[model samples]
Target chain A: MKNTFLNKKNLTWLILGVAFFFLIQLLIQVGVITPYYRVTMYWICLFAILGVSLNVIIGVTGQFSLGHAGFMSIGAYSAAVVLRSMPNLTGLFIGMAIGALISLFVSMVVAIPTLRLKGDYLAIATLGVGEIIRIVILNMKITNGASGISNIPYLISWPLMFFFVFVSIMFSANFKNSAIGRACISIKEDEIASEAMGINTTKYKVMAFMFGALIASLAGALYATTYYVIKPETFGINNSINILVIVVFGGMGSLTGSAVAAIVLGIINNVFQPLAEWRMIIYALALIVIMIFRPQGLLGTSEASLKTIFSLDTYKNALKGLIDLVTLKKFRVAAASTGKGKQR
Target chain B: MLEFLQQMINGLSIGSIYALIALGYTMVYGIIKLINFAHGDMYMIGAYVGMISVTTFKLPFVLALPATMIVTGVLGVVIERIAYRPLRKSTRVAALITAIGVSFFLQNAVSRIMGAKIYTFPPVLDNRTFMFYGLRFNTQQIAIFVTAILLMILLQVIVKKTKVGRAMRSVAVDQDAAKLMGVNVDRTISLTFAIGSSLAAAAGILVGIYYNTINPLMGFAPGLKAFVAAVFGGIGIIPGAMIGGFAIGLIETMVSGYGSTLYKDAVVYVILILVLIIKPSGLLGKNRKEKV
Candidate 1:
């Protein structure tokens, strides 16, 4: 009887989650969410997806990559090309899948050879690779080079997008707690230590790179599918910078922080699209401000766990605990040593 | 053979511009280990200053060129003090991010004030062509080469002979040791930026005259290309930057001229991949692992 009651609660939560998503989709579709906010919200959702993807590599794995837009450009162009060739909803799915796979493969090819280098070289190499990809796309015969691929099929709906976002979030969050996640965090903390401990540090780093690229490609695929158009410039160095800012602004290790930063940046980016010439300047300024003022990101490595956010006492204690840790490192040291003494 | 010679001549001019610009990247990278993405934008600003000096200030070509270079050099110092100085001891990534922000801010600020349309810059040299030994040459090309070489020699002298240069070198080798030796590390950094920015500025102005037009986005391609050159030649070495800059110009010019123009990006990337796969330390840079 108790088991049955637990199952019933689980079912109810699942229903509520689905219904909640459906309700939001309905509101947006029927104009209840306001057309004034649709495009901006869409960008937020997409950027949330991108930020989470980047957080996998940049935040969790602690690797500096500058070629994110290269993968994204490939995804976007692949989807755009495929959808242009075949204009069915099924085609959209097929194209996105194919595009994403291709992106994953290419990212592996790039990362495998390059990720071995540390510090400034990786940064430079990734940047070079990104520019190379941009220039290649700019010169390609199929994608129309600098003119950009246009008139892609608009095959995305709000529900479909929401579904993908949910899947990406769920997958990323789950991965964050997995054994692989632990290994990655260990590597990030100390590559030498991790290597000494028999972690295939190179393999794990490559995996993180591939994983981040795959998710970024998926986001890019979705972006291209929805807009029915994408240009090389759209996925150029500046786009890479924007995504980097989001990842940094979100707190590198926190999925929830990544999502929040993405959404906030997305809204701002979309709203300020009218400032076409100075849009990049605004992004740059925002980055400088964020780095100077709030280097840990808005959420600072804290997850938006339901229990933590919902419980008043938990939130207060967590806040107080964090303050204590920051302001009183000596106290933390004393506490740790005392705990060690107790164990002894 | 003659055609190849002409191509080499053309490449030398453009390559020198890249070398000048790469100096900005290499110096900043050597001192602080941060790739100032906005260094290219500083070149753009220099060009604009030169344009204003010539057209608005009504200075002669030579006077305007040096004046613009000085202005740009000053701007570089100001930017270093304002945007980069605070984050000096921070992680390399923080500075890199800040540089990106500064680049965008300057580009946008320029666009907002100058408008988005491509601006026409007045020609500095007469478009006279000279033929020698069945080879044709442009006056502007010759002038570009001469000016760049003169700047290179001047730079070599300053870096090698000057006391400030010695101070700069010491700072590059070990910041702490240099500071302990009574060198003002901050001043050296400022001076490095000033000199490097002036070189880049001169390149920008020279390109404006060579190309006869300027746009806000003009610096991006050359900036990236020059960065690649810095990487190719070994980023911290001045001589390497010069060689790498010319090599890239030749590679680009030859590839674009020989192969379809479309393959330009492919050629460069292919080379980058090959070099990285073979020699990750660059052609000149020695391997120094980051001791994290």
Candidate 2:
């Protein structure tokens, strides 16, 4: 395998990411970002990590898992247990390690049997598993049942969250470009064809699922530590759907898309926090509109790169399209009409 | 023994409502192969419509029930036309995502309009208890049971003996072939939605009268449970949905009665997973091997 980390493009992006992190840290130190907004930033990082990780299973591997919150809760609770006793950075890392191990075990057990089911059946089965996990947590004594675990010392700092999010994005992006990711993608495109090619579809699928579970667990640990209180209700089907919305809204299979969408949606949510009722209404409408108009999502599995951003041809094509729109071009109208006619 | 009998009766009553909702899920899944996650919200709309008819319009129970069914039935058709039909040629995942979006839209829209408060459904039926074979029965339970059975019978007659039923069956089997045979595939699918949604609406009204409370979010749990019933009975199989609904109802009641109530929901989900693992096609679903 090529050295993905040492490449010129990767190095430049890595430097840019660190520079951006420092800029954010500077802003926080200067009192520009309030505590409330900082919490929202934490959520954005959490969701970005979740979305990127989930994209591996649902996007790269062609598996529809609706039980992500199940793995997340396992991580949150396990980490909460450890942190409740220790309440330090070392405790946080230990808790995260423990959470990842548990999630690894659980994902293996779940993915082995459930991965055999196809499409909607898999979705429903995962949903059932997620709900079952939540219910069990709700009834557990150590988790405090429905009341949830409270007074967890807030150990997750902004830089720590940024580090985890950066790690998750890099890991998933690398996975997508690797041979195993190619095998998983082949399975997604056509399972029988991949199997004919002698790929171990089930094994790769299980691997991707385990990877997703591990990262999701890490995010869960971060979530528990950042929020100071972890509730079973926080990891319900709705939470799973919220993470799903992030992944889907960002083009599936595109790590950049997941991160972009997480940040955009996170900001939208925070901006509309006061108009809580209208916020969900608008969100639902946006989902529907996006599905109808752009089913491929925001980036459509394509990465946004510096070369593409800086290429003159890109700007020229965009300018041409804009000019066409302004000039009421007949060809554009004709093309649209023809497309509609084809639908009929 | 007497308590068991009473629980059995209670289970049957609740099971019938679940059956009504499950029929809608099974029918929609049969035609388009989409899970129609929004079907549950249709039930919630039905309950609200029924509540409004009784309280504001002062319609009697008999009249309000049909009114609710008609309104929600039409709404179902409109939703299919607007949200689902446009995505007919897209990937199944896109359609599924759209369905989830529709579900959220319905839930949030209702909550926004209705203020998310739990409205007390006016007592539309008489409240009376009677002893039957050393078991206590309430008038509302008997009424819900009887009405659900009648609706199921009516559905059976329509499906088996009517031309629209034949169209639905053929469309379910193969939409393109049915279209080639001049089946008006779109209309048939719409009709299926209408029928399924109407059944769910009737269940909603019955539930409202039974529980004496209605809310914007009340349909989520029952909708999921009914979906489990539909899958358990064999998704896309009419009879399977009915049997699955009642079976889930009975199992849930039995679990709550003998075990802890907290675990009842968990037990239902466990059953769903077990059925998916042991028999993905469900109890009555025919196992068809994948050609590819």
Candidate 3:
């Protein structure tokens, strides 16, 4: 464990991450990053955290969960209720903890039964669970019904948001490389084979699901603290799909991809803000186009590590791909027809 | 007791609409194993078309229903050709996501074109109420039930006795084998989509006339409920979808009548989870052991 943490590559990444964080903080202090942009940054970080956590379930564990926004609502509401009375950093922590606990419990209740189903069935089941959560919240008195809860103190800062984003990405990356993650992947590849090999499929699936729910709740807390109000409408199926889009666009299994996609998509959202009415239409079209052209996603399960980013071979391959695209040479090759074959 | 009977009648009308939509879901799933998330949006389009035909084109009610079905059916075929056919060999999740994208696209596009305001469907059918044994029934309710049953019966005949129906069945059973036997797999799939979409369109018209209000987002809730019905009956089974639809309709009506109206949606979802847990294969589905 010590060797893994103290390795040269790990040390370099840590330094880079800290340096980047400080750089962003310095920019915020200097007023170079305006308040408007800061809000956008907060959203990017929240989406990044959400995408990474959901990646643990969908990409790493190979389970299709569409109820992420439900868990997020739990955190947001719990935090809002707690902070309504306490309105302090300690209260924030307490609220986040409560949210995580509730999400964990709900996820356990949902995952154990639903995980036995596969693919579209699981997706629909989770979607139903999410809708049910939203409906319950909608009818609840404490949530103020459809009007939602307001007067929430904006306690979450840029640093706190960034810290949580970093922690979530780090945790997801480490989990992906761990034994449990491998077990989850094995189950994803073939549940029966993994079960035959003595891996407890249900236990690993439940663990991954719980982990996802926990992180989603934390992000939810951050989200609630950033905004002044929390509404049940915000945590509907559409919001869940929004997070799923980030994960899928980033490349499912890659944490780095999720973060990058979140930032990119967040910027796209900002750019399209003027055309608010057409935003969803364009977003839907983009989803269909991307699925048709590159179903594996932007990175295609490959992480953008320092080694790959800095390597000459990586750029060379990219150049070759570009040339191939322009020349239509790739399409002409019969042997290269399969979509998955071209990923590597 | 009279109120209970009234609720049951109401349930039957609503359940018939659900059955019509569920048939589309089941037929598509039978052929491609996809949930076709956008299937519900087709219902919305159908409603809009029905409204346009009746209000703008000034078509009679009898003619408007067929016009709506034909338009939605063609759109379904076009959607299948453009979005789904390419992803037929891809991952189920990919196809599912694309279906969702299509659904969102359809909803937003229609909303943009039609505006978000709720439009009152023209009361083509006379609002005549019939009373029998202290039970009240409306003409619209009777029309919806009768139209839905006629469509289902027509669908049954087509699927059971026609050449295209045979092709669809064979394709669903084994695509490659059917292809080997000279079945046009692509065309068969397209036809399946067409037929399924038309049924959903009929339901949409029935709903518009029955409810008296139509909106761009109207298809979402009913679509979900219909999907639940499809699963409850056995996702790919025809009779199963029909049975499931009526059962869900009755349950929903009964819940709202007896319990809080707010909990009706929640109750339907709970039923979905319970069905999934208790018998994932559904009421009429045959359990096939997973193969290695």
Candidate 4:
């Protein structure tokens, strides 16, 4: 584990991340990055966290869960409730803890009952769970019943949001790099085969769900703190689908893809605020078009690692593939003409 | 006793609409093993088309109903061709996502064109309530019940007695074998979509008339409930969908009547969870173990 973390390649990426972090801070301090841009940055970070967490379930574990927004609501509401009594940073920690705990419990509860189902059935069941959570929130007196919990404390700066984003990405990447992540990926590849290999498919699936739900809860807590308002409607099926969209757009099972897609899409969402109503339509079309043309998504199963990029290894492979395709076409033409000549 | 009977009657009326929508889900799932998420949009489109036929074109209820069905049926076929056919060999997850995208596109497009606000449906059926043995029944209720039941029976007859029906059942059983047996698999699939969409269109029109109001987003909740009903009965079974729809409608009405109306939607979801956990195969479906 220590070696993996301190490996020369990973260390380079780590140092680069720190440098980028410092650069962003310097820009913010120098007033070159405007306040509006800072808000956009916050959103991008939040979405990155969301996209990565959801990727664990949808991408790595190969389970279709539409209840992520429910977990977020749990985090946001619990955080809001905790903040109501104590308004300090410690209070925020307590809120996030409460949210994470509850979401973990909820994931376990729901997963136990519905994880036995496969494919679209599991998807619908999770969707039902999400709807149930939303409705319960809507009716709960403590949630203020649709009026929502308001005036929560906030993180107060860009660097703080960046800190959370960086931590979340690293944490998720580390988890994806671990043995447990391999177990989860095996399940995604073939649950029956994974079971045959003596992997505890059920246990791994539940753990993946719990971990994703826990992280989603944290993102929810951050969202609550950042916005200072928590509405039941805000954490509905639409939000769950939005996160799913990000995961799919990024290439399922690719952590780097999730982060990149989330950041890019987040910026696009902010820049095109006036066309917000049309955003869902566009996302839906994008999903269809992408699924039809490239089911592997924008990045496929590969990542933009430093070695591959700096060394141009991927470009070389693409050039090789192009040459192979041209040769194969010529071979086919020659074979077809030779067959015609033989017939003549 | 009288109030309970009235509630049961009301439940049956709403249940009929659910039954219509659920049949579409069942047929499509039976044939292709896909959830056809955009199906709910077919219902919404039907409502819109029915509304247009009545309010804008001055057609009678009778004319509007068939017109809506035809329009939605064609629309369903088009959707299958454009959005789903190419992804037939792809992963179910991919197809599912595409289905969602189609649903989203339809919903947003409709909302963009028609505006999101609720519009009062033009009164077509007479609203006079008649008391029979201390149970009240209205014209709209009777119409919905009779039309839904008749349509369901007609569907049963077509499926059981017609050549197209035989083709559909064969394709549903095994697409490759059906193709080898000289069945036009593509055309049969299109027919399935057409039948399902038309049924949904009927349900949409009935819902609009019953509620006397319509909106672009109207299909979302009912669509969900009908899906639950489909699962409740047995996803791939025709009669299962009908029974499930009525059971759900009854369950929902009873909950609203006896319990807090705030938790009505929650109750439906709870039932779905319980049903899924306890008997994933549903009421009428046989358990089929996964092949390793």
Interface RMSD (Å), every candidate = 10.0, 5.9, 4.5, 11.8
lDDT of 3 by residue, A54-154 (tens): 98999888899999999999999999999999999999999999999999999999999988888888999999999999999999998899999998999
Candidate 4 C-alpha lDDT tens digits along B29-66: 99998998988889999998999899999999989999
**Ordering by lDDT:** 3, 2, 4, 1
How displaced is residue B137 in candidate 4, in Å? 1.5
lDDT of 1 by residue, B1-292 (tens): 9888887888788888988898888888788777888988988998888888888888988898789889999999999987777666556666677787888888888988998788889876798998998788899988888898899899889989999999989999899999999999999999999999999999988998899888888887788778888888887888888988999889988887777777776677667666666776579978866553
* TM-scores for all predictions: 0.90, 0.94, 0.96, 0.94
lDDT of 2 by residue, A1-344 (tens): 25656888888779988998999999999989989899899989999999999999998898998899999999999999998889899898999999999899989998899899887778888888888889999999988998999999888787898899888998998899889999999998888899999999989999999999999999999999988888898998778888888888887777777888899898988988888768767767767766665555666677767786678874574355335434535533433332331120
Q: What is the lDDT of residue B189 in candidate 3?
A: 97
Backbone clashes in model 1, listed as residue pairs:
none
DockQ of 2: 0.49
Candidate closer to the true structure by lDDT (higher is better), 3 or 4: 3
- The two-chain DockQ for each candidate, comma-separated, is 0.27, 0.49, 0.52, 0.48
Residue A212 C-alpha lDDT in model 4: 89
Residue A320 shift from truth in candidate 4, angstroms: 15
Winner by TM-score: 3
The TM-score obtained by model 3 is 0.96
Q: Write the per-residue lDDT of candidate 2 for residues B1-292, one digit (tens) a residue.
A: 9889888998999999999999999999998899988988899999999999999999999899899899999999999998888777666777777888898899989999998889999999999999978999999999999999999999999999999999999999988899999999999989999998999999999999999999988888898899999999999999999999999999999899988999999899888888888898899988888767
Task: For candidate 3, give the docking quality class from DockQ.
Answer: medium
* Candidate 2 Cα errors over 4 Å, as ranges: A312-344
Per-residue lDDT of model 4, residues A98-148, tens digit only:
998999999999998788777788898899899888898898888899899
